[model samples]
Target: MCGIVGAIAARNVVPILVDGLKRLEYRGYDSAGIAVHTGNAISRVRRVGRVAEMEAAAAAENLQGTLGIGHTRWATHGGVTEHNAHPHISFDKIAVVHNGIIENHEAQRQQLKALGYEFTSQTDTEVIAHLVHHYYQGGVSLFDAVKQATRQLSGAYAIGVIALDRPDELVCARMGCPLLVGLGEGEHFIASDVSAILSATRRVIFLEEGDIGLLTRDSVVLHDKNDQVIERAVHVSDVSLASLELGPYSHFMQKEIHEQPKALSDTIEAVLENGFAAGLFGARAAELLPQVEGVKILACGTSFYAGLTAKYWIESIAGISCDVEIASEYRYRDAFANPRHLVVTISQSGETLDTMEALKYAKELGHNMALSICNVRESAIPRASELVFYTRAGAEIGVASTKAFTTQLVGLFALAVTLGKLRGRVDAQAEHGYQEALRQLPGSVQHALNLEPQIKAWSDKFAAKQNALFLGRGLHYPIALEGALKLKEISYIHAEAYPAGELKHGPLALVDESMPVVVIAPNDALLEKVKSNMQEVRARGGELFVFADLDSHFSESDGVHVIRTPRHVGVLSAIVHTIPVQLLAYHVALARGTDVDKPRNLAKSVTVE
Candidate 1:
């Protein structure tokens, strides 16, 4: 993913474009560049590092303009170099910054070369600049040229363009990628995300697919695919600017890890207030929950692990057959679709491309009932689904995803209890007990947060290790997978997870003193089996790091290190266990001196396939 920003105003827009690029830096940071319309031509500055470098260069050049567009690139089509950085200009007239892949860029590049246009950069985004320049010839306006170029492109994209000829105007379009138009007095802003321009304006209009936006200093307009003027409602974004700031914290990942208690509390309180009824999902959830013959979940990355955790609860607590599929893989395969099966999609940013496509594919296969569990409001997945549940985790800035994962589990747990009650799988007393346990989770999570000191110490040992093995059973197996995922994501350590029962089959060969084995052992029915697996690792002279409960009775020894949880958190232990695991990954990354918030080659949101 790449970040894109554009601004048109009566005052100099250099600082505004730079600040917007800074806010969007989390989306991409490999390279940065900007194009500003000067008196008679476009002035450009490109750098192969963070936006700060580009800002320094722009200041040195005294780049000044009333209209501009900027970009921070993640380098999908080219290497990280000054030449590959965006704000690709054509004939020193048309400048463009773009996000998402252009599937037919090679073909377009060949045709542009035949038409006598020279290329300066090895990027698909350069094609947009050349194509726009080609169409803007023979008296075509810049806005109409951009609209015409969009019709010839394939794949997802969000492009922002500016021309020296039309210095007071900015033209942008989106197809399958996020784009927003921010409203301001005598000024307007365009960005890949609302957070990038929130300082300029709280009022925003989310541009749908195939919609083109025209922004000027005094007016904003939207045009549909057929060149018809369209009216869109302006939404007031409630996300506070303070949420994006890291106050008294060294890194965003650590801050998000510490914020888990409040995040879980916020998510769970919504369910407690609503009494865990089917209506908690939506008004039609009561009618939909009772008619479900099976449950199918589609998700990707950390969200997929959350779905794996829900599969255990849905089957054991709700007495329903559940299958969890990776969204990217699910979209390409024949699903053996059944109309009676309920399709559920999970995503932190509801705009994840693979998950959104899978939701569309499921709907195409005759599934009438669809549900979405997401954190973002009005994202594509929620709009495409029939019912929706929001995880009130606020803004998760860390690329590794700390608070969003735990909050998704909270929502899934609520869904499990609600389905259990409706299907006669859980009695009234048991349902009430589940509710009481949920209410106590906020305090219990606080107790889990207290273990960070010891986790940080354990991370010292982990920082030196090159590999790790995580072992768990039943519902906790998914948590082991999540723990392993977190460690590898930020720490860059090679890690793997296996169901404890399968240790003797194959994973045991990798166990030794050099390979640390992390175990998730809560006092559940499968605890004994997990303990035996731990013994197998110990017998093989493997170092064991166990995250257990007070009732689990696991003790520290020469080869084993035990950190007990507050207590066995019935049914919700998966959510509690995730906290310490996240802390382990965070601290280990710190000890290893790796980038915790923005891991290498990873984007916070996977908006491209």
Candidate 2:
């Protein structure tokens, strides 16, 4: 996924746009470009690297304009080179910045070439600027040209166009990707995400599919594909710009990992204050609890792990059968869903492509009671669901999710406890106790984060290892899997996670001194079984890094490195346990000199198949 930002200000907007692009750099970092409209022409500057390079090049020259659009590209349609960078210009110098894929661009290129249009770069976005120029040359208004060009294009796109002739206007449109309009004082802004313009304005208008936004310094206009004017309202975002900064951490990943406590606590507060549990079933949860026969949790990546944790909570606490499936696979499978079944989708970026598709498919199959636990408001996933519980984990920037995953778990736990109380499985006193435990989660997470020094001390041991294995049992199995994923994703290490009992089935051969086995050995009922598995690993000369509760009777005599965490309840332990593992991955990656923010061959958002 690419990040796009446009501004039409009364004063110079290039600097503001560059600053906004820097804030939105987490979206994409392959290349960066900017297009600003001067008095008579559109000035463009681009480079094939980080935004800092583009800024350095721009600073060497003067790029003065009051209207412009900037982009940080992830390079899906072309390679990472200067020629493949964004702000793809037409023969007449019309510039465009795009965020999504054009599926039929090859055929469009052939048709345009036949009409005597020459292409400079091998980018699908280049076709859009040429297409727009073709329509404008044939006597069409700028808005009319974009409308005509988009009608012929197939697939998803959120595009911003700036023409030489129209210096005051910026035309933008969205299909399946995200786009938002920020309302400011005598200024207007457009961005792929709200963080880009959060500093300029709090009021924003989220563009829907087929809605076109025409931005100017004074006003913004919305129109349908049919060219009919439409009225749209603005929503003021609750997130502040300060929330996006890294504060004192070395990386966004570290800051986000530490923010888990506050994130989870805020989510708990929101759920209680907004009556979200009561909102789930509409009639105080008791009337509808008996009717729910099954639950299907759909998500992708780290959110999928959250669903796995939720499955355990729902089955154990609420006495409901539950299954967690990856959204990409869930959309294609033969789903046994009915009106009595609930489909819950978890996503941090609610715009995740596969999760959105799965939510839409489930709705089409007549699952009326669908719910979303999403961090982003007004995203496609929330729009596709019948109900939503927003996770107040403010903008997560790191590619590997940290705070968002933990907050989703908190929300799911709240839902499970509410349903358990409603269905007579737990009394009010027990529900209150659980709620009180949730209230103290933020403090617990802060305490867990205080173990950073110890975690860093063990970093060299992990950095020297070639492979790692993570093992856990019961609800902690998913945490083990997620810990392994974080290590592999950022450090480029070969890591595998297994349910401790499953090690004997196949994974035992891989245990050796060259491998570090991470055991999630919280002092739960399965602690003994997990410790037995640890012994098997030790017998095979596997280096051990065990995360255990303070009072757990795990011995350190077997050359195992034990990191003790504060004793927490079974339901809230996942939140605390995730912190040390995340810190371990962060320190290990840092020790190995890896690019912790943008890992190789991976983009922040997977918008395309």
lDDT of 1 by residue, 1-609 (tens): 778888999889899889988888776469999999988889999999889999999999999999999998998887888999989999998999998889999999999999999988888989999999999985788889999999889988999999888978899999988888989999999988888888888898988878998899999889987789998788999888888999999988888888888888888886778777888788789888888878899999999999999999989898888999999999999888888788999999888999999988998989888989999887778878888999999887888888999899888888888888888888979988988998888888889999999998998999999999998898889999999999999999999999999999999999888999999999999899888888999999999999999899888999999999989988889888988899999999999999888889988778889
| Global lDDT scores for all candidate models | 0.89, 0.85
**Model 2 clash number:** 0
After TM-score superposition, the amount by which residue 505's alpha carbon in candidate 1 deviates from its true location, in angstroms, is 1.0
Model 2, C-alpha of 452: deviation from truth (Å): 1.7
TM for candidate 2 is 0.96
Model 2 residue 196 distance off true place after TM-score fit, in angstroms = 1.1
lDDT of 2 at 605: 72
The whole-model C-alpha lDDT of candidate 1 against the native structure comes to 0.89
How many residue pairs clash in all the candidates, one count each?
0, 0
What residue runs in model 1 are displaced by over 4 Å at the alpha carbon? none
